[model samples]
Target: MSRPAGTKDVDYAQSMAILRTRFEWVMLIAFLIFLAVVPRIFSPETVDIINVMAIWVVGAHGLNLLTGYAGQISIGHAAFIGVGAYSTAVLILQLGLNHWWALLLAPIMTGLVGMVFGLPSLRLKGFYLAMATLAAQFILTTAFLFAMPGIVGGISGLTVPFPEIGGMSFRVPENLYYLLMPTAVLMTFFAKNIARSRLGRAFVAVRDNDLAAEIMGISLFGYKLRAFFVGCLFAGVAGWMRVCYDGCVRPDIYPLMDSIWYLGVIIIGGMGSTMGAIFGAIFVRLLHEMVLVASPALGSFFPPEIAGQLGSGLGLVVFGVVVALFLIFEPRGITHTWEILKGRIRHWPFVFAPG
Candidate 1:
């Protein structure tokens, strides 16, 4: 890790510590406090946006661990999220269970489902592995759409009650923000810790070279499955969050395009890092909002006949252009760029160049 001048690690403990200085600890605490109070500061619409960002953070983290860290390719992550959303709904509605219990079990159910699809990782890889997971997306979504109408609710989907306990409900935007943002923060902590642990190192090894990892006695089967399970587990948690936020669980909610966008999130945010997942989610969500706003506004500049076409088509064009620009110029993603800026700032005056 890069540090400011005079910063030195004298021991392994110091080197490994996330908050090495008083400033670091202070910043972390301040950030937490800010998150806690953000709903009070932002508009209700913006707060709702933040809630959605939280869901993306959780979903992106799952994909980061699997595709970015473990090198397992999946294009159907949203389907797993659907599994979680539907599972939670089923557990709560069909079984007469509490939403709390559903929350606990739904993610586990999704993880198990992910592991089943992950079986192909033992033999197939790359495009083949992606194809396998894509199949999972279609199969699971098909089931969600047509499985047991009485249980899964089929096309109309299931209606989930708002999260409530002890007479307090999180149905409103501000209250839901409190419920969601903290969960995203907790998941961030979990993902960061996982990235630095022994398991995380093993994941990196497998991602870099699976055969080499196996030669080094790393269990390819175990690690790959664990990656899929854990990643999909995050997706499940995100699904739960989304269902709770929307008050419904429908097949249309978790689309294949969403899974692709999650992949794009990690790619544009920088893969293989927890912060990358976060940065990517914020960037993508903000970009989405900006495009939505800008598309209609740009139509005003065009003639009436062309305005309608421009309004409908500009968003896709802008999205493609932005993604292309990032891929061409900043393939490492925003997190890597952030690190470089920090490095330059820290080394300014003596080692930094003017340009």
Candidate 2:
């Protein structure tokens, strides 16, 4: 039987939706396959870089969820990561807990701590909220240092235990890479799904206009707190992975500067995007490492001490300038560019889809 025009339109829409969903899944599967086979193709040094990129991807995803999708700026995200790292370290060292169990609990503990700090967000906005989060960084770091010198070892850092899986230790970077990669991929998937859900819409609505969102029956207080909790959960996972990779957890490891670096990753990568988090991490980490590698070559012309200082300082300056340029010119980020390319490929032989 011939369908009516309206019914045909609905069928077309549903068919397109299915096609888009399948395409997304196919892309994701292909990416995972590539990652799984990467160790076979790359040198160990390159694989180490890939592992670091994976860790940063997790941290960037956490920051993006809070500041990008939810419009909640956090200058002290690394503090929450520290909380997770220390919690895992303490559990393994002091309590003699299994590494796997400690890793599982780390994020939950960090999320609770994040919720406590996030309470201030109910009353604060913009700069004030950012300042409040920054305060969390100082207070937590100082507390870990002077307040409990015996426990956290003051200036000296606490050693982290090697992770064990199936009675085998993961001491090598390659082994740790395999351990971290799955968690990173799962977290990225989770973030993407959440961003496509109703909760994501609520976040954007509140971000655009809190008053209007509240008027529309969204609970501003509830959603904001949930966002903080979820965001910190990702941070905790990242921290747990960091401890596994480095085999140590120090209070100084998560400094104020580290927090600033994370924020920079999200801005340069693209806010409110899962792909942005991954792209930002890879771009920033690779750029930093490239500078370090080129430092000696650039240093030959200058005195040793001066070269060292200039190389480090110039690298940071260049990083800042790149971020500034991206913010001003490509605020939507590399993800936006990727999207345009994808759209063009998908609609070949057609000018463009009507808005």
Residue 347 Cα positional deviation in candidate 2, in Å, after optimal superposition: 2.9
Cα distance off (Å), candidate 2, residue 164: 1.1
**lDDT digits (tens) for residues 150-260 of candidate 1:** 889999998989998789899999999988898899898999999999989999999998889999999999999999999999988898898889999988989988888
Candidate 2 TM-score to native: 0.91
> What local distance difference test score does each model get?
0.90, 0.84
Candidate 2 residue pairs in clash (backbone atoms < 3 Å): none
Candidate 1 root-mean-square deviation in Å: 2.1
The segments of candidate 2 whose C-alpha lies over 4 angstroms from its true place after superposition are 1-24, 349-351
* Distance from true location, Cα of 69 in model 2, Å: 1.0
lDDT of 2 at 161: 74
Over the stretch 198-262, how does candidate 2's per-residue lDDT look in tens digits? 88888888778999999999999998888888889899999898899889877788899889989
